[model samples]
Target: MAAKLFSPLRLRGLELKNRIVVSPMCEYSSQDGFANDWHLVHLGSRAVGGAGLIIFEATAVSPEGRITPDDLGIWKDEHIEMLKRITSFIESQGSVAGVQLAHAGRKASTSSPWKGGVKVPEDQGGWQTVAPSALPFSDAYPMPVALDEAGIQKVLDDFRAATKRCLQAGFKVIEIHAAHGYLLHEFFSPLSNQRTDQYGGSFENRIRLLLEVVAAVREIWPTDHPLFVRISATDWTEGGWSIEDSVALANVLKTKDVDLIDASTGGNVPNARIPVGPGYQVEFAARIRQETGIPTGAVGIITDAQQAETILENNQADLIIMAREFLRDPYFPLHAAQELGADVPWPVQYERAKRHK
Candidate 1:
C-alpha cells in the first residue's frame, strides 16, 4: 500500500502530483510589493523540494491592504511580470503556482516582525487602515477608519482586479485570505464586527463582504482553475466566530463554487487563549469536512509524515498544508516520501542526495 501523503489529488482542472502543499508564509522582503531574488529563491527552492502546490504569501490587492511596507502586492500592472517569472519556474518544477489574494484591513500599516512589528504612522508613509468598525487591533495598533459603502465596494473591486492579475501571471490556483483576522476575517467575526448594516450584526451579514469578494473573484477567475478560501474556523472565544459558523460558511461557499476550505483557526482576537499543540486544529478541519461535505486542507502544527498520512487516510482533509515546517526544511516532501517508503522523484540535479533503501 502507498502512503496517502504522496497520492495525487485533483481539484478542478489542476491535478497535483502529491498532497503536500507549501502554505503561504510572509517573507516580508519585497519593496513596494515587488518580487525580487529573495522571493525567487525562497519559493523556487520549495518547488524544487517537490511540493505539489506553492501558494505565495498574503499578497495585498491594493496598496493599503498590505500588512507591512515590505509585504508583496498585486495591486498594479507592473507587479505581473515579476510574478510571472516566479510562477513559470514553479510550473517548470512540476509544482502548481498559487497566490493568496488578501487585504490586511485593521492589521495594515504594521512593520515587519523583524523590525519590532510596530504600526507605522500616517505621517511616516503609512495610510490609515480601514475595517468594518473603527476599532484597532490593540493599543499598539492604529485605530482604523470604518469603511463605508464606497469603501466596501472598493475592496470588492480590488479583489476582482487582483484575480485578473493572478491569471495574467499564469497562476493555477487562487486562495482568498479570509483567515488570521485579516480584512475578511475581521468582517466575519462578531468579535470585531459590530455594525448594524447589511454587512454586519448577523451571521449572514457578517459574512457578506467575504461572500461578495468570493463572488466577484469567481466572476473573473476561469472555471478551469480552482478557487480556495482560508478561514480561521474559530476565534476561540465565547460569542466569537465558532466552528459552527465555519461549517455554515463552508456550506455557503460550496454553493458559490469554492473548491476547498483551508481550515485554520484563531486570529480574530488579541487575547483569545488557544490550546496550541501538534495537529491541534485538525479537529476543526475534520468536522468541517464531515459536516459540510466539503474538501478541506489541514494546517497548523502538522509536522510529521505519519501525522499527515493519518489525516488523509482517516478522511479528515484532502490536502496537507505546512508552513513553518517548510521554512525549516525546504525539501520536506522529498524527505517525507523517503520516510514513508514512497518512491517519489527528486529534482534531477539533486539526485545525488537521493536516499537508497
Candidate 2:
C-alpha cells in the first residue's frame, strides 16, 4: 500500500499519526532560557489544529551555543519545567512533541531578526563564540575562538546533558541541529573551516565532530525515541559543502542510530545565492533519502495540500515538515485532510467547524 500524508509512520518506537510535522521555527520568545505562555499557546495551538508532530525551535545545548542569548536553552535542569508543560499539552492534543537540540558555535551571539540580527557587542549581551576554526561568521561578527580538543569534548558533554533534560521534559524526538552554517555546518564547509586538526581539513576530518556529537547524543537519548539530525544539504556556494557531501554524511549517520535526516540547505555563508521557491529544498531531501535509504524530512516553502501530498506520493520524503505554513494556519493538517479527502479527527471543541452542508 502506498503511504499517504495522513497515514501513521513509525521510526524506532515513535509513531507519528500523520506525515505532517511542524518544523522547528524559532519563536525567540524565551526569557533566560525559560519557556513561557507564548510557547505553551504557540505549540499547543498547532497540536490542537492537528499536526502529527510538533518540534520546538533550535534550542541551545549550552549558554554560549545560543544564536542569541535570548534564544531557548536546555543547558540546565531548571529549563525543563516549562518545556514539560508544552509537551504535556501537545500530547493531550494527540501530537508527538519533538525538540531540536542545537549549538550555534561561530554563529552565536547575534541580534534577533526583528532587532536587525546584526552582530551583538560583548557588553551588550554578546559572548565569545567558538567553532572548529578561529574564523568568524563574517567580519561584522566576532572572531571565534577555535575549540580545543577538551572544549570539543565539553560541547559533546553539553549535548549529552541536554538530551537527558529533553527526556525529562518528555520530548519524544530529539533532533541535533547540524546544518545552516551554525557550529556543525561550519565544520562541514571548507569556506569556514580552515584548520589543521582532526576536526577539520579533509572531508573525513571536517565531518568528524558532527559524527561524534551524534554518537554522544545517541548514547544518552533512549533507543525507543526517535533521533533526528538536521543537515544543510548544500552550502549553496562554489567549493563549499555540496549535496554530494551531505549524501555521504547521511549514509554514515544511518549507522549511528539516526532515525531521520531533516534535510534543509544553506546558512553557513552570508548572502549566498539560494533558489528559493515552493518546495525549493525538497530535491535535496529526495536525493539524500534515495541515495542513503534514510527516512528524511522535507522542509522549506511547502505550503499547499497538493504539493505536500505529492511529496509523499512520489516517495520524495518520508515526512513533510512545514514551518511558516503551520504558523499561518495552525489547523493546516485538518484543512489539508479535508481538502485531500483524508480522514482526520477534528478537535472536539471545533467539531462544529467540520460540517459539510
Candidate 3:
C-alpha cells in the first residue's frame, strides 16, 4: 500500500500534495515586523523540501501582540511586499504557505528566549501587554493590563486587518494562534483568565472573543481558502481548559467554518506536569477528531516517518505537523517518500540527488 503520509488532502478549494506539514516555529529574527531574506530561506527551504503545507510562525496581529522584541507583524501594509515574495517562492515550489495570526496577551513584550526570556522594559521598545484579565504568565513575564470592551473590539479589528494583509501577501491559509497560552488560549483557560465579563466565567462567554474573531476573519478571508485554528487541547492543569472543552470548541468551530484544528497541548501555565515523550499529544488530536468529526493536525514530538504513517493508518489524525523535526531536516517529506518506497518528485535543480531504490 502507498504511504498515507504522501496522500493528497483537500480543504475547501486547495488540495495539499501530501499530509506531512511543517509546523510553524517562531523565528524571532524580524525587525519592526517585517519578513526578509532570513524568513524567505527559513520558510522557502521547506517548500523546496516538499512539505504539503508550511505555516509561518506566530505573527503578531498588533504591535503589542508580539511575544518578543523581534517578532513578525502584519498590522500594516508595508510588511506585505517581502511576505508576498516569500509566499510566491513557496507556492512556486508546489507547497501551500500559511500564516498563524496571534496576540501574545500577558505573555508579550519579553526578550527572546536566548536573551534570558525576561520582560523587555518599555525603555527598550517593549510596550505594555494586554489580556482577558490583569495577570502575568509568571513573575518573570510582564504584568498585563486587563482588556476592556473597547480593547476586545480592537483585537478583533487587528485580526480582521491582518487577514487582509495575509491575502495581499499571498498566504493560502490562516491559522488563528489560540494555543500555547496566547491571547485566545488565555481566555479559554481559567488559570489565566480571571475575568467576570462575557469574555470569561462561562464556557460560552470565554469563547465569545474567539468566535467573534473567526467571524470577522471569515467575513474577509476568501471562502475557498482554508482557515485553521490552533488550540491547546488540554491545559494539563485542574480547572483549566481540557480535552472535553476542545471537542466542544471544535464542534462549534465546524459550524463557524473553521477548516481544521491544530491540536497541541500545555503552555497555559509555566509548571504543568506534562508527560513529555514521543507522540504524547497525539491522543488528544485523535480524541478531538473522533468525537468531533473535524480534521485535526497532530503535533508535538512527532519525528519519524513510520510513526507518522502509523498515526494516519490508524486514523488518529488527518495531518502530521512536525516542528523541531522539520528544523532538523527541512526535506523530511522527500526523504520519507524515499524511505517508504513511494514515488515523489525532487526539484529539477537537485535532481542529481534523486535516489531511487
lDDT of 3 at 207: 92
Residue-level error in angstroms, candidate 3, position 327: 0.7
265-348, model 3: which lDDT tens digit per residue? 999899999999999999999999999899999998999899999999999999999999999999999899988888999999
| Lowest lDDT block of 10, candidate 1 | 348-357
Over 1-357, each residue of candidate 2 has an lDDT whose tens digit, in order, gives 333989999988879999999999988888788899999999999999999999999999998999987799999999999999999999999999999999999889888889888888899988989998888878878889999988999999999999999999999999889999899889999999899988778999999988988888888888898999999999899999999999999999999999999999999998899999999999999999999999999999999898999999999999999999998999999999888888788988999889686
TM-score of each predicted structure versus truth: 0.99, 0.98, 0.99
Candidate 3 segments exceeding 4 Å error: none
User: Largest lDDT belongs to which candidate?
Assistant: 1
- Give Cα-based local distance difference scores for all models: 0.95, 0.92, 0.94
lDDT of 1 by residue, 1-357 (tens): 999999999998889999999998999999999999999999999999999999999999999999999999999999999999999999999999999999999999999999999999999878899999999999999899999999999999999999999999989999999999999999998889989999989899999999999999999999989999999999999999999999999999999989999999988888989999999999999999999999999999999899999999999999999999999999999999999999999889999889664
Window of ten residues with lowest summed lDDT in model 2: 1-10
